[model samples]
Target: MHEFQLPDMTCGHCAGVVGQTLHLADPACKFQVDLPARKVTVQSDEDRAVLAEALADAGYPPA
Candidate 1:
């Protein structure tokens, strides 16, 4: 699992968007977004950079 800090994620809608975007990037990947903690954990074979790009494209840039 890979963990990313998404400080800008502030609501259920944002988490849903991020989760959907992540799924769109890699359909088999599993993810959990903790909006209160500003963190996301992803389980996948894809590289972190690829995931980061997907998050960025989804409007929730990862740190």
Candidate 2:
């Protein structure tokens, strides 16, 4: 599992977008969004930098 902070994620829609983006990047990836913590945890075999770029491209630049 990998962890990142997505400060811009504020609602279910944002969560959905983030989730979808990750899925699009790596369909087998599993994610958990902790809205209050502004954190996202992803379980994937993909590279972290690639995932980060995918998230950025999806509009939720990680912290």
Candidate 3:
């Protein structure tokens, strides 16, 4: 599992965008988003760098 801290993710819209973006990158990926904690935990076959890059591209770079 890969975990990321998204400090700028503060609303449902942000979470949705992040979730959708990741899913588009890897359909089989599973993730848990914690809004209050501003964190995301993901389980996927994709490499960590790839996932991080996708998130960064989608404007949710991990902290």
Assess every candidate by TM-score. 0.94, 0.95, 0.96
lDDT for 12 in candidate 3 is 100
- Regarding TM-score, does 2 or 3 come out ahead? 3
Error of 2 at 1 (Å): 1.3
Clash count for each candidate, listed in order shown: 0, 0, 0
Segments in model 3 whose C-alpha atoms lie over 4 Å from true places? none
Q: Summarize candidate 1's per-residue lDDT along 1-63 as a digit string, tens digits.
A: 889999889999889999898898889999987788999999999988999999998888987
Q: In candidate 1, which residue ranges exceed 4 Å CA deviation? A: none
Question: What TM-score does prediction 1 earn?
Answer: 0.94
- Tens-digit lDDT track for model 3 on 1-63? 999999989999999999998898899999999999999999999998999999999999999
Q: Kindly list the per-residue Cα lDDT of model 2 for residues 1-63, writing each as its tens digit.
A: 889899989888999999999999899999999988878999999999989999999888998
Candidate lDDT values, in order: 0.90, 0.93, 0.94
Which 10-residue window in model 1 sums to the lowest lDDT? 54-63
lDDT rank order: 3, 2, 1
